[model samples]
Target: MQHFAQYDGEWQNRAELSCLLDILAISSRMDLRNEITKEIERLTKTLVVFLQNPNVDRNKLEQTIEQLNQLNLTLMSSSGRVDQVLGQVDLLKCLAQRNSIPGGSCDFDLPAYHFWLNKPLAERLQYTQSWTADLTPIKQSISLLLQFIRSSASPNTVIAKSGFYQQSLDSSQPAQLLRVSLERNAAYFAEISGGKHRFSIRFMLPADTERPSQTEQNVHFSLHICQL
Candidate 1:
């Protein structure tokens, strides 16, 4: 499931960026410099390879590459201005530590954070907005990539006999991800897994909080083998 894993990773990164943007909105400051820089570097490297692929839309890829290069230049300036801005606000690290404790972040746990929270909402939003501006390019690129990958496949209605289904994959067109859409109120969730040669899906009931058990009844769902 190498292709699936790669697509999953991009999705996860996009989720992380979204979470950061949300947190930044309410807080005056947070040390997300390291995180942003790391992501920028990773995205830059990936985009380089993505741009080389002739199969992808050249116009869109060029636009993304332009945005990435511009952002990279700004962040990598020798003056180190962005680094300094990030160094002053490490509140997120402190808050994360407190959140990991038995109880959530409380005044006694993160007094400094509490102080920041008391600031005017407008001021906090402005500061966070400035910081998150650096991430806009990466976010945009990931969104485009995900949209392209998803649109590459058409969903097929399939039935899982006795809660199980398997299909042999065509090596010529390897899938990037297996998207399974079940009924909104279905009693069970689909557990999908497979490799380059074949794939399988099994509907399982949420037996307990820890693990789900396979269902005995047959299941029906729509499957999309995304390949881009």
Candidate 2:
């Protein structure tokens, strides 16, 4: 294909290679395989917090342990190291989104905007201060998250899923996010499939769904790899 023809022969371009590795990183997300693969990262972080505090809030701490128990189910399919890195990235996104629920119709609320407009300047300033205190770190995390988003970014799913990287995909449509690059690092793409003719990536779907039939190959994705 014309797209892959660009890097068909040269594999030593470090910049190109780095980009490739980063591409592979997000490729895991596009196909939806890595969403659950991020358990190791999540558990390790939670474990640290538990140890540090010695008395983690029981309800919240219990949640981490439960998730850790599911880690094996999520990680069984991929190589340990490769999967771990993806999981760490997902963990970062998870940390960013822990309490916030995902939704749309944002920025400003019509009724609320009118109400705020009627408020005095002193109240507006106080509201701004409160909003900034609560939202600034989450905003910063989102900025960092953008650097890790490789294939494509969808406004719908700001959080990554469960794989080594987090992800959120359309439940009825096989949405794709692909990133192509000439440069990559060998560390990320280890073994190179024992020198295979070509390498591609794919992922598993979440086990439970609202409409099981919807995901029985009805809404899934594939990441095709091309060498140029």
Candidate 3:
């Protein structure tokens, strides 16, 4: 639980970037304005912090900054067009509330949404794609940062006797992420927890709505102590 706290920001941003990319691929334009707005703010803050950090790679930082500047220009030029599209996407709030229900997006539930969906597919695709064009820089930057972080450490095979494992870390070399993977046929999942100086993992069997208990047998898994 504690180790997870360390990379929450990075993971959340990564997830948002991924979701945006997927949504951008579709012809239906759900109101992605809020998501895009939030990600733009997050990326700007991240880029500012990166530029201020002297220890970061200068070459990579320069490339990222250049891309961000171009994206800023795009954003400024398309502000009005983007706003018009956002104004027309008024079903987002209702869609959010009923998303979990089966057949939630039926015509009766959101007639305006159905009307938009009835537009020519090509037009829908064009509008949605254009709306996210200015986000290219942030998408690229997030992808690169995640790749760098994951590649910073190599995976090692570890065994948990009776489904419990613990290890002490060298405080000087702090890990930014902890990855635990097991064989496809394995019957248990790993519950990981740790702090800056140590880490622990408990392998527990799958239990639906019931408390999961640790496995009594030894478990084999791959551990990646990612550092960035």
lDDT by residue for model 3 (1-228), tens: 123222325343233333443444342354333444454455556566777788988788778656655655544444433224334445544544455588776779868656655565456455446555545544554455566568768899988999999999989877768889899899999998999889999999988999999999998899998865
Each model's C-alpha lDDT? Answer: 0.64, 0.35, 0.63
Among these predictions, the greatest TM-score belongs to 1
TM-score for all models, in order of appearance: 0.62, 0.20, 0.58
After superposition, which runs of candidate 3 have C-alpha atoms over 4 Å from their true positions? 1-88, 97-104, 118-120
Across 43-101, the per-residue lDDT of candidate 1 in tens digits comes to 55766787778798978877876765665565455233332333455775555445557
Query: Candidate 1 — which residues are off by over 4 angstroms?
Result: 1-18, 21-88, 208-211
Instruction: Give the Å shift of residue 76 in candidate 1.
Output: 9.4
Q: For residue 85, what is the lDDT in candidate 3?
A: 31
lDDT of 1 at 38: 61
Candidate RMSDs in order: 9.7, 22.3, 10.5
Task: Tell how far residue 73 is off in model 2, in angstroms.
Answer: 27
For candidate 3, report its TM-score: 0.58
- Model 2, 79-175: lDDT tens per residue? 4333233354442233223314443112242334334434554554454344233223323333333333332343331211222222334434342
* Segments in model 2 whose C-alpha atoms lie over 4 Å from true places: 1-115, 120-125, 151-228
When 2 and 3 are scored with lDDT, the better candidate is 3
